[model samples]
Target: MRRTQLLAGSALLLIAAPVSAETLKDALLKAYNTNPTLTAERANVRAIDENVPIARADGRPALNLTGGYSEALLQGPGTNSINSPDRRTNADTQLTVPIFTGGAVRNSIRAAETRVDAGRFGLRGAESDLFTAVVGAYMDVIRDEAIVGLNTQNVRVLDVNLQASNDRFQVGDLTRTDVAQSQARLALARAQLQTAQARLISSRENYIRLVGDEPGVLDTPPPVPGTPAGVDQAVEVALQDNPSLLAAQRSRDATAFDINVARASRSPRVGVVLGAGYFNYLGSLGAGSGVDVGSQSGTTGTAGLSLTLPLFQGGRPAAQIRQAQARRSQSIEQVTEAERAVVANTRAAYAVWKSSEQVIASAETAVSANRLSLEGVRAENSVGNRTILDILNAEQELLNSQVTLVTARRDSYVARFALQAAMGRAEADDLGLEGGALYNPVTNYDRVKNRWSDRGRDVDPQPVATRTNESKPQGSEVTRPLDPILDTPVDRDAVNAPSKRP
Candidate 1:
């Protein structure tokens, strides 16, 4: 008996324990660490870093080796033609060191390095865009869940109203029309509940797709920090710090370097060439011939300076220079385009965030007034001064306002996050993601930019992102309950008291 009592007490404790909810920070951290799009962008930046080493190779020393062996198939016809050696083998090694290439190699290396910087900025922009999407998905689930709860509660309340209307009709106190009206409203509320549940399921699926796991109970997200004071401030900050704009500017600078690289092609190049050779007659030299050959093996070496001047390049160099100049011009215009887009996006996000704030305030007031109106309608119906339809309409108005309030809160939060993202302040570092050190693209660029070893290579890549295929299917469960204020009861005497109308 004591064991049974202890087991029962343990079960009770388990039931009372609260489940630890997932926070916005936790979700953002998961996305940051495992998102596939962001992972691919990091790889692309690493690839760009390799271009620097490739350009440097053009100015580095190169060595080559060649070897050949032959057994005379048929001795070249001719006597006194001192038949050539019946067997022969030879080997040669050469080294070429570039001394000058105008400025082609130098300017090409500079362009590649500049592009690496641009790629890193592009990676930052991708990170910020990903975080914004995650935030929107998170808020979507919260809003839809609340809407489902509200609709569920409405269905239950309407069902109760329908039963009461039926009771009144049986006693002849209410007409059959009154009972039918409650029945119709109840049906509509159930339909709305189904719609709300469907929307919630979609939101949960999207959350799983991004977060890499089925969402458990998600806590209310904390307010986004560091919102701009106004649209002008937001645009000012974005122009200075936005990743997209910075990347465009860097790309333009790199293109300017490309023009120099193209022009360098027209200049003279100089280099040094050194070579060594060995030959072996394989004991067959002068065999059976009256000629004596001393020592059938020999070695030789040579070194000299080489120069190349392009007298004419078939007009290729001129065309290349022109092409590069055109590209630079395009890049200049693109920088301006990026600036325009940043200003427009920042201002729009700011306006939406501000408007959402106003809508939230108005919705809160509407919810309060509608709740009081619902209570008054119920009191009037109890005294035969209001029809059943009046109560149904009041309930619906209250539900509308409640739903509006939920949606406005969601919009406000998401807009604020969007605003921050537009201003280049919504990356992992800005959010202070806690589990690990943030990925530093510069670490990779620095590692590979000057690499000289041919045998050097990074380890093979394994997937960093988690997969969600095996997780349980998402359901339409509501994580948050409807507001309790909706249930506040008003005194019948106060509701029925005559109003002092002006």
Candidate 2:
């Protein structure tokens, strides 16, 4: 019984222990596997892939069957039964194979294939965008948590100072004004802590929304890899590798093909038509006829080449060709626009990343100097050379600098990630996510591009992304215990003591 009790106690301890810290890569991997937006884009690309086979089907053979039965209720008085076939039944089957479509079928297939490539590049763009958002949210939480910790610590320190002020006043060593100043500072510190905690909660909620899980103790993220050394280099890489630009270029190529498909409307179409039919007279052909019909059934077969030329289409073909040409022009302009945007974004991200580094360096210096200044002011106050307000001001400056430092670090990291994304290097593969193979749009495209089966289908889709509502409610987990001394009332008699010079 004692051994059983010991075992249960050990299990309870293990259950209560905190889980290991979650790393940035872990959060990114989860978002990659479960983000709804990325998943939907992937599905859209797969749908686009089907267009290839759909276009090809237009050039393939088509077979159709028809059957019918009919009976004449009344015939003309002079009509012959053999010629009219009073009761009749017929069945027919026809097969038509396209011999040539004046390049319409060929270009349509090419356009569809090009669009599939464009969709794949678009998927890559979506992936990069999602990873950038996750990186921002992750950094925001870390920054807010640090700010909350700083404010909480400030509150505790102020509470202790307030108590000391009350003690000095009771001994007639400090004035009422000094104690009031300390109390006011402590109140402000508490308010700041509350605000910081609120911001922290908001950041955590955002993190959960994107990452699909409550954030645990997050490990500090490593520096973003593959950062370009300069803006020019970054822009050059972006112009070459940016998914948005590449997708736009592909779309332009597809539109060129679209123009060819439309111009084919004026060209002649040729095909082979083969048909077979059967007819039954229902035994009514020889009834009451002077001549006896040898048989009441017959079969017919025919095969021939079919041709169609567009003589005049009420100017519709010309209008369609012009429309396609205009669309190709628009696509060409869009490609240029995408390129310009990529260059601007790459340059801007690089600038921000560099500036953030400078801000971090400056903030660190300010924090260190402020800390030394606060210490000196406190030492001077101990010798009655500095006023209480001077020490208070020093502490406030130090807190401000420390908060700035924390914020700058977070900004720097997020900006670096943005830069990497702009340069087309922040995707899942670029990040080296583990635990599974990366989702390749080509896999789905290759599987469906040449498919000929009519009944093939994927399994019904279940929800891949996790819902946030099912997770625990977000709260400020970075809160610190309030100083117990803050709750105790100051001795009223000490507060009522007359002011005295130190």
Candidate 3:
């Protein structure tokens, strides 16, 4: 069994270590450079780019060409007829471009541009989320590394204590109760060590899977910006940057355009046409009229416009307009609600972080106090001045304080990220960190979409941002190794740069 386990461990290590393998940054950058989601979103955004051309085409001249042949024969006619079966063929071409459409074309093009902006915001949001995910995974690896070290130190300390107690008992210097107490303490510590080790292993595995490879020492990011002057300011920034809100606004605008399009449908549409033709006359009432004469040709051109007015349609257009208005209203409500939600989250995270910051400091001090008390009790126990139970109680207090400090620190780190997220400001740039090759969906979109589109570039300038729900596993996010906020001051301007939201 021992041999089997040893072999398995060695195999895992071998798999983790690759020869000539890429650096962690290299690997992540490569994957980011070609991630399918980014590419997919970029294409979606660019598809929005075509609306301008389509709308403009509606206002441009339309030209068409037509040609046809016809043949007729009359048998046993009594007299030279003015009209007999006439063989005729006509070739014609006409061009008609709509010179105007009240507001349909302009409104449609404007709507498309607005939709593009929404996509840009959405893409920016997704970019921010990707950065957050990568950083969180990186942080998880760091946290696990720290915990493994801490657990190792704890197990060693417990082992030494147990050995010391055993030595004392061998000489009949320590009571059976003292020996038993040391053994029990050592066992508890060992259990904790095992649990910690398991967690570290699991965490490392999860990070590797998400990141696509084993992690190494990551370049530490600069500290986060301090809390803004107030929560309202933070909320304002979030409201402006949050892609979800922007998308909602875009939705409302598009619906207004839809109203224009629907209203225009009730109006008449006009255009122009030109043509040329050839004809053969088979019979004529005049005495000189010839039968089966050579075909004569004639050409003509004319400007004409065909209009379709919706006088009535069972109230369908009215119903459509009402539906569009309702959608616009719904979108407005969504934006308002989204803004409120962000504000509430920002406040909540701020409160929790502030409280945890103080608690972490206090807990560290408690751990120190408990450690000293446990030492004093142990010293007294050696001299038969303190009871074994009392020493054991002191040890428990020290352990509890350490555990509390660990939890508090973790909570503080998590809260900071949550706050940043609430503010719609969590991004790769926010970390002042960079990966090798960035995956840029826009560039990829241009390369793929430009091939068939004349104005592909104009279509999809918006960044794609995806919205997530509460169903996301919050605990999956990794805690940073240390609090940058507590360690170093961050630049406020750098932190609050204006642009698309993540």
Candidate 4:
């Protein structure tokens, strides 16, 4: 009974050990939460968020404190010796506030806010890139693993063939040349298996670097996110949602505000200053000469307004305004370029995705046909109607077809992901991956935008009412349902049709 309990306990331990197969969603969530590159970009966004406060500081009040003490010896010409002591002490406080800057400060603040918005969009672009990269790595690992399996099976089959060929040669059914051919093919198969193993190792290392852990048996990837009906609709969606284009648009808006700021540099500035002071003179009477001092103290206060107009600045303000205008023009060109690129890329990805589906279907058919041919050839060889070389060749053809089918399937999935990414719909919510907290760039921005304290770091922003003034794409033309082909798994039996001839 004790031995039985020990065996049962061992079985329970084996079952309880954590060795769950990782999924594509797990890899994506791992990358999203732990990737150092993404984390660095998040920090960069937070740093950009500080610009708003820095700009607002130009329009806010500033206070300063001042204090000083000095001791001196005075000597004059009256019995004239160096024996006069004098001391002075003073303390002062001053406050200066900007009343106006001809709208420069306000425009600067606006520009900073726009830039912050641009940074947020930039972060979104980084996220898309990161998720895309994780997808690529995850798929690479899966692809290499399948290739390794195929290679291993190929080697095993070749080994068995080599042994059979040697036995046939001994029995006088096969010649020595045929046995040599089998041996050579087995050597090549083993080499191929080694190559596949190396590739699998490399892919696993990359997975570790990107996902922060070694890979496990990964589940098959699910269908990708938001799908468009056609290439035109995909391009349209990209134009509306692509983060890079949105960033450029915000940047253009910011540069326009910058032009206003540069022009404001030539306008008049108004400010108010308030000062209060306490002055004290310590008593030091005349000693050997005619040096005299008396104890005295007084407090004084002043308040005044000032204005300054820029009359001449060596044409600097004009040059600045011109520079700002040029930058605005450059940003506009950037937005145009970004739009063009998005349209071209979206169209290309959509075409690739559509083509991959066709490739998969055709490759599956080829595999099925080749499999039937292989079986028929083997049956003929069993009756001495076909040679061993013919059987080997048929097997090779079937293996090649299988490999091609696997590659086509992998490409189909990858292209679908690329299509989703090109349309800016490859985010966590769209993919239904709810593993961890989604890092919202706007959360950090809103948290730091109006911060006034310097004690602790800013807390993550709580959910607030949506801003109605937020910019949005206007008048979208296409709103079709997600394409069923891209959004649902293809029919497996159709993709893996049985050998009809067999």
- Candidate 1 residue 126 Cα shift, in angstroms, is 1.4
Residues 99-214, candidate 4: write the lDDT tens digits. Answer: 98988999999999999989888888887877887888888776776666556556656666676677667767777887787788778878887887787777777777777766
* Candidate 2 Cα lDDT to native: 0.82
Per-residue lDDT, model 2, residue 54, is 96
Tens-place lDDT digits, model 1, residues 1-502: 3234333432332222136888899999998888888988999998999999999999999888999999877655573223578888999999999999989999999999899989989999999999998999999998898788777667766766776677667766678898899899999999999999999998889888887877777887998999677899999999998998999999999998899899988998999999999999898887788678788889999999989999998999999999999999999999999999999989888988999999999998999999889887877777667777998999899999989988988998988998898899998889999997899998988898777888998899988888888988888866564455533333323222332332
By TM-score, who's the top model here? 1
Task: Give lDDT tens digits, candidate 3, residues 17-89.
Answer: 2344334345345334444465566677766765656666777665566777665465475644444434556
Clashing pairs in 1: none
Stretches of candidate 3 exceeding 4 Å from the true structure: 1-39, 64-94, 163-191, 205-213, 240-243, 274-290, 296-301, 386-400, 428-502
Q: What would you estimate as the lDDT of candidate 1?
A: 0.84
Q: Model 1: runs farther than 4 Å from truth?
A: 1-19, 79-84, 483-502
Q: lDDT scores for all predictions?
A: 0.84, 0.82, 0.58, 0.72
Best-to-worst order by lDDT is 1, 2, 4, 3
Backbone clashes under 3 angstroms, per model: 0, 0, 13, 0
Q: Estimate each model's TM-score.
A: 0.90, 0.88, 0.69, 0.81
Q: Indicate which candidate wins on lDDT.
A: 1
Report the poorest 10 consecutive residues by lDDT, candidate 1: 9-18
RMSD of each: 6.0, 7.2, 12.4, 11.2
lDDT of 2 by residue, 357-472 (tens): 99988987787788778777766676677766786787788789878888888888888888888888888888989988999888888888787777899999888888888887
After the best TM-score superposition of candidate 2, give how far the Cα of residue 418 lies from its true spot, in angstroms.
1.3
